[model samples]
Target: MRVVMFGYQTWGHRTLQALLDSEHDVVLVVTHPRSEHAYEKIWSDSVADLATEHGIPVLIRNRPDDDELLQHLKDADPDIIVANNWRTWIPPHIFNLPRHGTLNIHDSLLPKYAGFSPLIWALINNEPEVGVTAHLMDDELDAGDIVLQQAIPVSPTDTATDLFHRTVDLITPVTTGALALIAAGHTQFTRQDRTQATFFHKRSAEDIRINWDWPAHDLERLIRAQSHPYPAAYTFHKGNRLEILAATVSQNRYGGTPGRIFYRENDGIVIVTGHDARTGNNHGLALTRVRTHTGQELPATEYFTTMGGYLTRRP
Candidate 1:
């Protein structure tokens, strides 16, 4: 079958690679252009680069609704349109072009965590599992009927990066399987239950701010979730922004203001986190590794010789 693939970022790059490896002919690839900014880190292997390497026609456009792009799609006459990590809203005319319509690959299980940065969000929330969802594209964002979904357990020690690689490894199988199902005249789709639907907003600079008032366990989860590759969870120490690389829930109970450092040791920096309602006292979050604004990564012991200062809160 002739296929038109729309994708961006690392997820898109991997999906396109899988499609190229499969039996179907990829007629064209649509991907967003690299940003012109110097400081912005490109997290994924470039989809456009990958497509170009395979000698496939690549369209670098931000909006899929452009008249020229739509005309190009019509000219290609694709049997199916496969989308993965393609940001921006794809208009119905564009999505409905192919004979089999558009199928999308989403990072999370649909009806939950249906927006950006899904893996990071899942880790922060302490979700038990995370996986991919290949579904038929409808008018609603990620509300499409599910063609296939397979979950993997979220390990306690799994960071966002760890889960990302695990999920990426599954995309080839899931995508190929979904395509196989569609090609075999199996067009059935399981309707998602609307009652349990949840959508999250795109992450921002503000989302990485570590709130000391949160419970110790949640804070520990946040640190691991946002650790390296993604932005590290941070708080202001002295006059500089301090990025926390690793942390754990401190067993010791302490009494102090939520943001204040209550105890310091070579192993960890035990700071008061939140009020423990059961004990009517404050709990602790221990920071094991951190990097200061000076670009120096160090253990908690080296970072702080003296404690008992309140961490600055910034919006």
Candidate 2:
């Protein structure tokens, strides 16, 4: 069966590679255009380069609803459209263009994390398991009928970067299996339950700001959730912004004012999360790795030489 692919970023690129390696005919690829800012993440190894290398037709457009793009989608005449990490809203007219309808790949189980950064949100919330779902695309956001779902257990040591690689790896096999089912005419759809659904907003600068007032475990989770490739969770110290790359719960427990350095080790510092509003207990996050404002990565002991002042939300 012919497939019109829509995707962007490493997630999409990996998915495209899987489709190319499979038996399906990929007719065209629709992806986002290049970015002006070099730091912008949306401009990763997009479908354009991969499509060019593979000799597949490519269209670069942010919005897929334009008249010309719609005509191109119509002309491609794809039996099905496979969308992964596609950034923009795809109108129903375009998704309905294919013969077998559109299949979308989401990073988490549907009816739970239905918006951006689902895997990160799941880990930050300390979900025991994360998952991948392949489903039929509809007019709404990620609220599609699931065709295939598989869960991966979340380990305490797993960082967002770790889960990201593991999660992207799931796409190749999940896509291959879903496309096989579609090709064999054995497609089965499970309608999503609306009551259990959660729609998270796009992660912003505020989300990355660490509140030491939060439980130590929660703060630790937040730091790991945004670690590396995404953006490190951070806080303000002595009128300077510092990025906390990683942290863990203190093994030797002691308590003080939240965000105040309570104990300093050769490798790290234990900062108190005095009492959580929800949990009603004292906890302290042991900062093991940090990055200074000068962009120098250092151990917490080196970074906190003068630490009477508390870490704050803003500098």
Candidate 3:
């Protein structure tokens, strides 16, 4: 099938690579405009570069509502459109251009995490399983009919980056299979249950802030969810922001104040969380890896050496 691809970020890059490896002919590629000034540029390959290498046209538009985009779609005349992690909402006119219509590959199981940062949100919420869904695109965001889906296990130690990689690996095969089935008219899509749909907002800096009042297990999940590629969970310490990269639920059951930096331990610095006020569980989470403001990530042990004198329990 003649396919037009739309995507950005690492997940998008993976989808583009998978399509290139498959039998489908990608007619055009659309991606967000590259930002040179962002502190951490997430997009790895220039979709334009991949398109040019394959002799496919490329469109770089920040917003899908632009009139030029509509004209570009009209010119390419694709048989099918595949969108992966596309940041912008595709206008209805463009979605209806292709004969087979547009398909979206979202990183989460739809009718659940339907909006931005599904993987991150799932981890933050302590979901044991995360999956990907390839669905027919509609005017609403991720509110479309499902064609294919595959679930992946989320380990207690899995970070957002880890979950993302696992999800991409699982989805590649599902996506390829779904596309072939759709092109061959062997598949029937089903509309999603709108009542079960839930949307999540983009993760902001504030979202990454560590709230010690939360349960130790919940705090641990939050730490793992935001670890590595997604900005680590952070908290203010000694008037400086500290990003916590790795943590473990402590076996100790001392009923200490939440956010209290306890004495340094063998593995790293131990921190206490609020006694689950509801359940009365006293065990708290511990930080194993961390970074001080404007500093590179360091083992919690190494970081505590220089700053340990200033560390005090959070009030």
**Steric clashes per prediction:** 0, 0, 0
The model with the greater lDDT, 1 or 2, is: 1
Candidate 1 off by > 4 Å: 36-42, 275-282
Model 2 lDDT per residue over 228-308, tens place: 777789898888999998788877666567778767754678887845423335657889889989999998988787666
Candidate closest to the true structure, highest TM-score: 1
Q: Which stretches of candidate 2 lie over 4 Å from their true place?
A: 36-43, 274-280
Worst 10 residues of 2 by lDDT: 34-43
- Clash number for model 1? 0
Report RMSD (Å) for each prediction in the order shown.
2.0, 2.2, 3.0
| TM-score of candidate 1 versus the correct structure, residues matched by position | 0.95
Would you list the clashing residue pairs of candidate 3? none
TM-scores of all candidate predictions against the true structure: 0.95, 0.93, 0.89
User: Between prediction 2 and prediction 3, which has the larger TM-score?
Assistant: 2
The per-model lDDT (C-alpha) reads 0.86, 0.84, 0.79
Model 2: per-residue Cα lDDT at residue 57: 96
Judged by TM-score relative to the true structure, which candidate is superior, 1 or 3? 1
